[model samples]
Target: MRIAVISDIHGNVKALKAVLDDLAHQAPDAIVNLGDCVSGPLWPEETAVLLRDLGWPTVCGNHDRVVAAGNVPQDNRTDSFTEAALSAESLDWLRRLKPAIRFSDEIFLCHGTPRNDDAYLTEVIDGRGSARTADEADILHRLDGEKAGLICCGHSHLPRVTHLPASGQTVLNPGSVGLQAYSDATPTPHVMANHSPHARYALIEEIKGTWTFILRAIDYDWQSAAQTAAANSRPDWAHALATGRMQDGA
Candidate 1:
């Protein structure tokens, strides 16, 4: 079976469009969207409607939680005043999303950790050195311990896969389609501006007894998207989109 894993789409309709267009060639069995679908630069209403049309399996995220609460964070302001607005319907969709999903004995999905919807698994926090149990640590820790063969997730906005020799689990994070936090180059125009703005995603293929996790990055019309953000009144978010960085590194 083949599956595409995607997450952290924070609006940026152009990136999502480019990714979908590219994925058409692969024709995977199904696509799994790991929430945070519409909460950034582009129009959340448009982004949410489009993702709903895709009809992919999904999970909820922290940004979705904020949208649901209908109250933006007070101190955690990342974007300038211009770029943090969201539509009412968009917030409604986010509030209704689920947190985690399980698939078969070998596959599980979540926006963050199984324990909490808002917990993030970055290299620093969940690295091998900090992990405790085999299945309960980070993604790699859980994958190795569960021996479920494969586990996919998102939230770090960093695309990566780790193989644990101790328990034989392969953990994968497909990164963000809208905002990428960890990159080869730090985005500079916003935060990691030097980084490239290629929408990233993942393709999981189980052939025979072997499983392959493929990371993909595709080019989108980020310039136009940024321009749109500037026009819409959220220049900070728009700049982050073009630079591939988040306002608060979330």
Candidate 2:
């Protein structure tokens, strides 16, 4: 079985369209979304509508939860923008999403960690916002004894595939389909950047009892997306959309 995995769209519909176009050719057996779908300065309602129509298996992301709850903090401008843009129907759809999905007996999906949508599963972010791949022990600890052969997650928005030798489980993060880079002030002050404005996703296939995967970064009209962000009064998002890098010092 082959599956396409996408995550962290963050409301950039142009990027999402580009990814859908790419997927039309790849044509995997199934598609799964790891959430963080519509929380940006761009087209939240439109993105949500498209996702709802597609009807892919989806998980609720941390931002999705924030938007669905309708109690966004004043400081969270992204979630606030999304909340204002989404209609009641869109918000309800988000509210109904689950934090995790067992796609199959061998496949498990989550937006971040299994127990925490806001936590990182495969990456560790320092207090300064720099991120590094977590060690095997750390990843296992975060897994909390999840026994699925294939574990998929997104949140860090970095494309990665890790194989845990001890448990023989593979973890895949397909990266961000929309916002490739951003700065966040959460558990710490930090930035996540891909260093290039490419829409990213992953395709994984199980064959003959082994799993193989590919991480893809597809080109799209990022300049238009950047201009949309700037028009929405988010110059930081514009910079990230255009250059896939945070402005100097962010």
Candidate 3:
């Protein structure tokens, strides 16, 4: 069977529409959305409604919980769009979301870490990778041996595919559909329209006895998404939408 794995769709309806249209041709058996479904420059309510209508199984993202709670700290407000999206209704949905979901004997879905539901599995930074090495590895190891054959997680907003040979598990992050946020030595990668937008997702195909995880990036109308951010009085948000940079080079 084939499953389309999507994650971190942060309220960019335009990009989501493009992705849905593109994936339709592939004709997957199911589409599973790993969370961070709302809280962005665009209309989050519209995005939530669309996802609900599509019957996508979703988990709670960190920001999605903030929206559902309507309790974002004033200092963390990156843009006006962020401020506007925090509402009671959004919080309600987020509160209702399950932290982890088991798809089958082989597949599992989650927003953050399997150990702690609220953990943010950020990539290693500085020498911290060495000191914190065992922390990351241990969780992955446990998940591999006991949880499911394939473990998928969102929330880092970075795209990656890795195989845990010891545990016999494959872990994947499809990145962010709305915001890419893959910063390294470079400021950010500017993807042209011809290139599939910075927007990325994954396609899981089980052919024969093998499981393949293919990470796909698609280019969409980022400018329009930026415009939507600006119209919502979120210029910084628009800038972030166009550029894949994250806060503090995250």
Q: Could you tell me the lDDT of residue 189 within candidate 1?
A: 21
Q: Alpha carbon lDDT of residue 80, candidate 3?
A: 33
What value does the lDDT take at residue 90 in candidate 2? 99
Assess every candidate by TM-score. 0.78, 0.98, 0.81
Residue by residue across 113-165, what tens digits does model 1's lDDT show?
Answer: 65555554434432322222223345444333344566677766778786766
Q: What's model 1's TM-score?
A: 0.78
Model 3, 75-147: lDDT tens digits are 5553235546545555566678877788888888887666544454534334322112224475564453455
Look at candidate 3 and tell me the lDDT of residue 166.
Answer: 65
Candidate 2: stretches off by over 4 Å: none
The order by descending lDDT is 2, 3, 1
Taken over the whole model, the C-alpha lDDT of each candidate is 0.68, 0.94, 0.69
What's the lDDT for candidate 1? 0.68
**How much is the lDDT of residue 230 in candidate 3?**
86
User: lDDT tens string, model 2, 1-250?
Assistant: 8899999999999999999999999989999999999999989999999999999999999999999999788788899999999999999999999999999999999999989999999988876679998999999999998999999999999999999998999999999999888887766888999999999999999889899999999999999999999999999999999999999888
Give the winner by TM-score: 2 or 3. Answer: 2
Residue 38 CA error for candidate 1 (Å)? 0.6
Model 1, residue 143: distance off in Å is 7.9
